[model samples]
Target: MAAMSKPYYVTTPIYYVNDKPHIGHAYTSLATDVLARWKRLEGQEVFFLTGTDEHGQKVEKAAQDAGMDPQSFTDRVSQSFRVLAERMGFSNDDFIRTTEPRHKAACQELWRRLADRGEIYLGAYEGWYAVRDEAFYGPDELIERDGVKYAPSGAPVAWVKEPSYFFRLSKWQDWLLRYYEDNRRFIAPESRRNEVISFIKGGLSDLSISRTSFRWGIPVPGDEAHVMYVWLDALTNYITAAGYPDESHPRWKFWPADVHFVGKDIIRFHTIYWPAFLEAAGLAPPKRVFAHGWWTNEGQKISKSLGNVIDPLALIDEYGLDPVRYFLLREVPFGNDGDFSRAALAGRTNGELADALGNLANRTLSLIQRNCEGKLPAPIENPHLMHDTTLHSGISDLREKVGKALEDQQFHSALEHIMFEVRYANSYITQMAPWALKKTDPVLMLQVLRLLHDALRVFGTVLWPFMPTTMDALLDQLGVPKDQRKLADLATPLPGGIPLPPPSPLFRKIELAA
Candidate 1:
């Protein structure tokens, strides 16, 4: 495929600041980070943004319970998220906070733009509001059990009646449906697309965009009586981080993001409400909103009450950041829900990392050092016809397949393809018996070693996006220059006869205590 000339913009849903960072937060951020890293390596201009959503009734009440002002509470917790991002090695270009002055300006500007366009109107809202979800529920969307109404997710709801501002979301139903039909990739995962299309087809109601009962959010521009709803405020952060309201801003060129990665539960807000708001403001909707499934703890929903919320910091401390990042993306299909288990993590690390990749690097580098006097051997021209042809074909095929997988956002499949190459190289080494050939025919041994170097170079380049640290180690052992690491470099071999570094294990086995 030809290289993409346009910039790529991607975002993670701004996390709520009411709680500490958890595995779900880590999962989404890591996925976005991997994409950002891969795109940058593929030579695209990329922008990755992630931040905390600090405005809502939930934050207000949580602050009250904690005996501190809302800002103070949010500041303390929001830092934890920032720390988590750094701990996980997230390559985010911007970290936007709703309370930031720039974000406030963006939100106010969005409100004025929508209101001036007549998409905002005064209205009274009476419905079941779930504090846990920070969302309002229609009667039909709520479930009643034991005389109490709850959200479909089992979060308790409260009856709320207040004069509020509403966005004319209903008016865009047909436009949204037509947009979805025209842009089939707008909502990702075939299953997610059907769900979103069905929801929009059912009909969209005017969305309540302001709350009067709380003052912890961005005040509606020119109207202090109400604050913007948390969802509206949060959704605007994407544009805010890219410098909206000031089109001349340097990052503004990437506005109308290429993709917005979000959790499945909030698909309606991202796929429906967000697009309507953008259309009302005379801006283009994001190119795609891919809502991925949630991760449960040991096959059960992650909950604080259940004492099963996986702390991401704890996981990082237990396993290094890259390993954690690799496991999360490689273990589950991006949009499919899965369970997080320590045993499963250990298994991948032991089997794939230690046995396959790490051992291959150790074996190959050790052979080069032991047999070639610690000097890289130059590759013979065209080695053996059959062996050279097979190696070239396999590497070329794997590169194309991996590139396609990344383009489709199939991260797991991409990693799996690269590992398959690793497996093949290991098998080829054993079958060819390069070590024995060293004593019999030194020239043929050099040819065999050259083939190994060619394959390792390609594998290292392709694996960089997933296991960056390990890939760098492999490249260093092969004496590859940092500047030589690029997607295109996968097709070429590093010059031989350059001294290589002594090999070391890439991954150490993690033993879980009984």
Candidate 2:
């Protein structure tokens, strides 16, 4: 594919500050980071944004329970997310907090625009509200169990009645349906798209845009007594980071984000409410919203009450970072709920990382270093007919195969494609017996070694987005230049006789505790 001319913009949902950073948060951020890195590799200008959503009733209550002021509470919890991003090696261009001054200014300006467009009106909101979800559910959408009401998500709800401003969300229902129909890819995974369409077809009521009961959020423009609803305030972080409220800002070119990565629970908010607000504010909706499924630990629901919340940091500490990153994206198909068992993690670590890719790299490079005196082997002008054709074909087609899979956000398939080549190279090395050939046909041995070297270069460069640190080491061992690591470079051949650094193992074999 040709290099993209327009900036490729991507974002993770700004995580709510009421909870500590968890695997769910890490999963979304990592996926976004991988996409951002891939786009940069594709020679496209990219903007990746992630951060904390510090406004909401849940945050306010959490702050009070913790005996701290709202800003102090958010400042403390928000920093944890920043730490999570760094710990995960996310390549976000900016970390936007909802409480930032620029974000507040952006939210207020959006509100003013909506109000000026006559899409806002004063109203009293009386409904079942779940503080945990920061969402409202209609009577029909609520479930009653043991004489108590709960949102569909199982979060407890209480009756809330407050004088508030409303966004004319119902007015844009038809427009949104039309938009979804026109842009079929607006909501991803087909099932999610259908869900959003079914929910909109049911009916959209005007959404409560301001809350008088909560003092923890951004105050409404011209209405100090009321604060903008948390979801509206939170969603504005996307454009705020893209320099919203100032179109002339350089980053504004990245507006109308190429994609927004969100969890499945919030698909309604991103698909239904966010677009209506943006359209009313005379701004474009995001091009796509891909809501991924959740992760369950040990085949059980992961929750704080269950004491089964999989801490990403703990996983990283126990297993290496790249292995953890690989397992999460590789273990299950994207958009499907996955089980995080130690056995599954260990299996992929040992079987794929340590044995397949790592073993291949170790054997190929060790042979070159020992036999070729740590120099890159030269590729013969005319190679062995049978052994060379298939491996070269696989390596040559790798860039296109991986690129197409990644474009559709198929992380598993992309990694699988690379692993196919790895497995093939391993089998080829065994079949050709390059070691035995060293004494018989030294020329054929060098040719076989050179083939493996070229394959490793391609693998390292393409897999860098998924496993940056390990791939960086692999590329460095191959003496690949720092600047010459783009996707386009995969087609270029390296000159022979360049000295290579000593090979080191990319992954350690992990033994799961019984």
The TM-score leader among the candidates is 2
Model 2, span 340-459: residue lDDT tens: 899999999999889999999999999999889999986556554745588988998999999999888889999999999999999999999888998999888888999999999999
Please give, for residues 1-514, the per-residue lDDT of candidate 1 as tens digits: 2357788899999999998899888888888887888888787889999999999999999999999999999999999999998988888999989999999999999999999999999989998899889898888888889999999879999999999999999899999999999999899888999988887777788999999998899999878999999999999999999889999999988988988999998888899989989999998899998888999888888888899889988887898766787789889998999889889898889888888878877888888898998888886566446444666567778877987887777888998888888888888888888789887888877777777777888888887777777788888888889988877666466667799889888888989899
> Which ranges of candidate 2 are over 4 A from the true structure?
1-3, 380-387
Q: Give lDDT: candidate 2, residue 3.
A: 67
- Tell me how many residue pairs clash in candidate 2: 0
* C-alpha RMSD (angstroms) for model 2: 1.4
Local distance difference test values of all predictions, in order: 0.86, 0.91
TM-score of each: 0.97, 0.98
Could you tell me the lDDT of residue 247 within candidate 2? 99
